[model samples]
Target: MMKILIIEDEPSVRVGLSFTLESKGHKITTAENGLDGIRIFEREGFDIVISDLRLPGADGIEVLKSIKNISPDTGVIIMTAFADVKNAVEAMREGAYDYISKPFEPDELLIVIDRFIKHKGLELENIRLKEEIRERERFQHIIGTSPAMQRIFETIEVIAKTDSSVIIYGESGTGKELVANALHNLSPRKDKPFIKINCAAIPETLLESELFGHEKGAFTGAVQRRKGKFEAASGGTIFLDEIGDMPLALQAKLLRVLESHTFERLGGNESLTIDVRVIYATRKNLKDEVKANRFREDLFYRLNVLPITLPPLRDRKEDIPLLVNHFLKMFGEKLEKSDLAVTPGTMDMFMEYDYPGNVRELKHSVEMAATLCKGTKIERWCLPAEIRGDGETPDAVISVFDDLPLTERVKTFEREAIRRVLEETHGKKKEAAKKLGISRETLWRKLKEHGFPVSPSDLEE
Candidate 1:
């Protein structure tokens, strides 16, 4: 049963509405005035609020504004006997879910309440579904079945429930922004705005106003009051990407907002309060920054309430094939090349190189291969020179020396090159075979003959 609040100054009307709503199997709470109703509404949780338009002390509009300020998700219906179209339009403009006329049929009021309640239910369900989709997308984007990534997933699940500040730390190109998006999408504020500000991208002089808004004539270009990311993200989440690059002066202001959830517009004394969840991501070491006095220690503590570290792609090489396949499908669809397929030899070539640029580099490589491949299959020649060692064909094994006796040299340089490729590719025999210009079966036989490990799992570890 949904909880409904009835706020009307008239004793008879309030009691009648309460009785009718209670009869409909809803738990009802009655208030004699708008002030009392707002207090109860703030102190207690209700699914929907029904407030009379005219009330003593605080008016219905004020109550509706307060309700929206506290919880935008709550459904508010304004009741008015004045019957002024202007008042109804104003109430709707101020975010009232709906307006009800006084002296209305009990069934009419019930229908309005039922419809709004159903809408609220659907809204909540949609938010939940969106969050699930975001989580799935985040997982799909970061292909890693390693223990490190699994732990990160578990941490994301636990922290997404609260509006606490989050700090994500990782190496460059480690997908910190992706993690930030995951946090915002999984949070309760998922349905609301999810604003991202790249602190490093914007100029330091403008970053303050960009975050806390500014009043008209606040600066040279300030002609009218402008809402910043924080205000725009009211009742939602704001992702501060590359926050470690934020100016020291702005960091203090950010700390103030985090401490009180209140901030004044630039060049304005009026302080505005917003309910915004902050998620910060950065590649810089905040602790080192703090020690060097570049980053505020207090602000660091505030943002680092729940810290998450993303493992580098190199650290989880086992995920390379999964990432490759994912990127292949993604870029193929994006480029309209659905028939694009990487030869086993070409894939092996990929395993040989250490992707210093991480997942981003891998994605670019896949897109390039898909674009450059003229034939149905992407060949070794399609891959970059760094990936394809010595630019040899897959089936051709390098001959170290034709003049040297077999007994004089125990190992051929060709065998050494193949072993090096296997090591680089993390032992995925198919990837190794591609790198060595050999078939998967040949690579497997060669590995068995040479006592070299040849599984994706072995390579990953």
Candidate 2:
């Protein structure tokens, strides 16, 4: 129910309107004058405001302007015995929902109020939906539900509580930055800023100054004192991506900062202290870099204190269908359509190909399919050419020649097909059995007859 405020100088009219609105289940409050009405409006938020055109002291127009300035969304309806054309037009121009002449029927007032309430409901719902969309977009950076991801989640839970430096180890496109964000969101410092720097993206010559900041005339281009990532992320987290690409000489300075939580700006001897959490991520193996004396051993140990590794997509094939469904729902909502489901055949095709770019590549493929799929169901044809190629299909199971021992060859092929299906489906026995057009019991019997390995782990290379 909406809360409504009624402003009228006449005591009888004010009581009558309040009683009528209250009978309709709206919460009602009354003010004798426009000034009192504005005071009540400010102290308590109201969904709709009903006020007379004339009132003692501050008039209704002044009250309407004040209420609107405070909360523009509060619907205002103007009522006046003097039905001047100029007054009606000006009230509407001033953002009143509608103007009603005095001696208006109760039914007419009810109808107008009902319509305005309906419109307000729709507007609120739209705002809520937009907020939900924005929240989902923000969380889209982190996407995974595999065993490897579960472990990462556990690690994030533990590490987020502390302000310790972290080093994330993963291949390119493994969402290292997403992990960094998750850390920030889960930490007590969530309200603070999160600063990110890509060591490889910036030139080595400028990187030191970029990180440690610079004082005026520190270098040729240094015109004024500058704050760097550490200072910017003070009391927050700074994610240094591709830290393995940092120059060897700078590694010493970085190690000192990590050890002491202090650094000197370029050409400035004043030591600046920062209370920032440093999270580093790199595609290159730091252990190998340290062995080659390219990365500092002490720095490696310091950053690697709380390491999190993201597994590639190939190793977590079981998560593809889940990820595909998630992306389809996400894109469908973004495009203002009902959710689309991928066909089993399309899922089979996705399972067969090796995603070279891991989860990032899979997301791109799903987005492409969702865009191309005109129908509610996404088919194999909607998939990218690389994923839809003929080479990935199970044509080997199809007998081209009918000449050689038909029944025996067919049985052998069927068994092999079932095994291959099982492998592709990640040893979900029931799903594999269904895919092979056999009962679960029959698949189990066949597995026993063939002496197939009992453990699902045996299928992995």
Query: RMSD of each candidate?
Result: 20.6, 14.6
Candidate 2, residues 1-461: lDDT per residue as tens digits?
88999999999888989888899999999999999899999999899999999889788789889999999999999997755668878888999999898888877788889999899889989999897555434443465567777677778879888988888888887778888898898899999989999999999899998898999999998999998888899998899999999999899889888778789899999999988888999999999999999999988888888888888778888778877887888788866658698889889999888888877878877876675555588877556656877564544324432454877566555655665576478768877877888777777777765544454433332
TM-scores, each model vs. reference: 0.55, 0.55
Best by lDDT: 2
Instruction: Locate the minimum summed-lDDT window of 10 residues in model 1.
Output: 393-402
The regions of model 1 sitting more than 4 angstroms off are 1-140, 389-461
Q: Count clashing pairs, candidate 1.
A: 7
lDDT (Cα, 0-100) at 423 in candidate 1: 53
Error of 1 at 326 (Å): 0.9
For candidate 1, the TM-score is: 0.55
- lDDT of each residue in 62-117, candidate 1, tens digit only: 99999999988888999888556688889999999999777798998888888987
